[model samples]
Target: MITAFLHGFLLALGLILPLGVQNVFIFNQGATQPRLIRAVPAVLTATLCDMLLILLAVLGVSLIVLQVVWLKTLLFGAGLVFLLYMGWSIWRSPAGVSQAERPEPFSPRKQIAFAASVSLLNPHAIMDTIGVIGTSSLQYDSPDKWVFTASCILVSFIWFVGLAVCGRLIGRFDGSGRWLLWINRLSAVIIWGVAAYMGWQLLASA
Candidate 1:
């Protein structure tokens, strides 16, 4: 059990530590929102989405779904489209340092939508969850499996909250908003790069 717990925690932490579209979106929300509380919707939505994916992956449901060729193609296509649009949206967002020049914060609805898109629509994230965590669970059984699942889920929740807090701290300290502007631009580039990679995969699979 201890081994399972440690394995799950370490695996989850390693998988999530990478910089990705999902991470970028959550951090941007935390930094751009007027208050940390305003970023709760994004934080919660992303965490929940991750929890769902982990559950599906561990239970082998996602593995079964991935067996369908058409579904895989569909996922890649949809993910590519949304990632491109999302990249554009982030890149164009205003980076005003002052309250007057700053654009309005995203409403809870928009935050939730974007969070879900980044979480669920990205083929790379889904593949990572299904490929790594899902396969890793095969090493355990019964109560141990459940323990592993719980550990992974717990890591995800805590990590997302921590990310939001870190972003908030940076936003609070960066009075000039120059950092935020660069962050947005960089995030957009990363997202677009991911989209292009996915597109290449889609074409290869074709």
Candidate 2:
């Protein structure tokens, strides 16, 4: 159980350390929001989505889903399209929040929806959970498997909340629009970057 817990925690931490679209979005939101609490919805939503995926993967549902070639292909295509759209939207968002003309904070609904898209739609994230975490679980006994699953899920929450907290701290010095504007630009890049990678994989597999 100890070994399984350590393996799951370390592997999950590694897979999630990338500056991927989901992480970028969560960070940007935390930086942009007027209050730290405003960023909570996005953080929780993203964490929950990942938790669900990890759970499903550990339970072997991911393997079952992967058996459907056409369905997986269709999902990949849709995810790519969604990523493009999301990237464009972020790029077009207001550059900064000034006292005179503050940009509206993302509502709870919008935050959850976008977070879900970034978390659930990205083929890279899905595959990592399914491939790394799911495959690792196969080597564990029932007790160790549960411990591994719990530890992996725990890491997701820790990482997401930590990111939001870091962003909140950065927001203090970046009161100007410049920092946030650049963040949006970078966030857009991250989103499109993942989209491009997935697109290439799909093409290569074709």
Q: lDDT: which candidate is best? A: 1
* TM-score list, all predictions: 0.96, 0.94
lDDT by candidate, in order shown: 0.90, 0.87
Candidate 2's TM-score: 0.94
> In angstroms, how far off is 94's CA in candidate 1?
1.4
Worst 10 residues of 2 by lDDT: 96-105
lDDT of 2 by residue, 14-56 (tens): 9999889899989888877889999999999999999999999
Clashes per prediction? 0, 0
Per-residue lDDT over 108-165 for candidate 1, one digit per residue giving the tens place of the 0 to 100 score: 9999999999999988889899999999999999999999999998998898888889
Against the true structure, whose TM-score is highest? 1
